[model samples]
Target: MVDHVYDPPERCVAGSVGPPGQRTFFVQATDGARRTTVSLEKEQVRLLGTSLVQLIDEVAPREGSEEAAAAYLDNAPLDAPFDDDFRVQRLSIAWQPERERVVIEAYDRPDIEDLMGLDPEGDYPWDGLPPQSLAIVLDAPRARAFASRCTASLEGGRPGCPFCGQPLDPSGHICPRANGYRR
Candidate 1:
């Protein structure tokens, strides 16, 4: 497995492209010379942001954390002219107490059918090809900033239906609460 480790990336953030209801989400990590970008589901971005904020609050509760986050807030769009290294299969985050950092890992996906068809007693799955991954570590303040950007990006998307909580497309969606009515 190739692990692109950015021990303390110069910048890391979540961003999206395209319009709401058809947007493609991505997470990017960059040092100076190398930048790694990976595409992921919108839900993954949401959960990561939520988890980052929750984890930071749990470990580094301090006055002015929000204010401190502003200092590191990166509202800049993702670096352009870049191709995604891979599509994220799984995302995991954790706190590093000793170093006082948050570690985020995005694992590249393997074929679902191959994974499901694995033979426990046969040769290991993935055969000769190992998936690549991206790992990023950030300080608490930067993590908070990253989380804020995530929340902002999500809120800019399509408005949610009051009754069903599903995103309302540009043409409206069939809300379950509305009994099949497109609203």
Candidate 2:
């Protein structure tokens, strides 16, 4: 008999929430499919950034799907609210199956404006450096399942000693305690 193991779900490819007061937004996942919609308070729209129209033009998907979600991220035209002198230096993607969420972490650098061609040697007038981190959550079950399968494959392939329940390497272990007890 073939034993079917429980697999988690996939991670979300993309998602977003409006600023304050707006209802929460979500990109729900279904059978490897994704759906996007505006489901949040009106006040939340302000948090999207200063150029709402540009942001929507770049990120808001006319059609909902994983591909569309990825496109949104690739073309996201995020603008700095405080100043026009900033750029994303690094970006990281993480999926949490237990929480049913996908997180995008971004780290901004001081010379971002110069790198993005906005300005050369432009002084960022903000009180302090822009935050180094940002997170966006999306719903993706298939991603979670994939992650689970990968993790299982790695754990199942580990070599261990049957008698002692200890992991074994090609180089055998010398157990002094076992030898002393035997003596």
For candidate 2, lDDT tens digit of each residue in 25-133? 2222222342222122222222222222233234432432335444323222112122212234444445454764444333444344546975656676543643533
Best by TM-score: 1
Off by over 4 Å in 2: 1-140, 175-183
lDDT per residue for candidate 1 within 1-183, as digits (tens), equals: 448999889988889998778888888888997999999988899999999999988998672189889899898999985479888887889888899988988887654565785665667434466778888888888989989988876767888999999888888999889899998
Please give each candidate's TM-score: 0.86, 0.25
Stretches off by above 4 angstroms in model 1 are 110-128
lDDT of 2: 0.34
Against the unseen true structure, what C-alpha lDDT does each candidate score? 0.84, 0.34
Clash numbers, per candidate: 0, 18
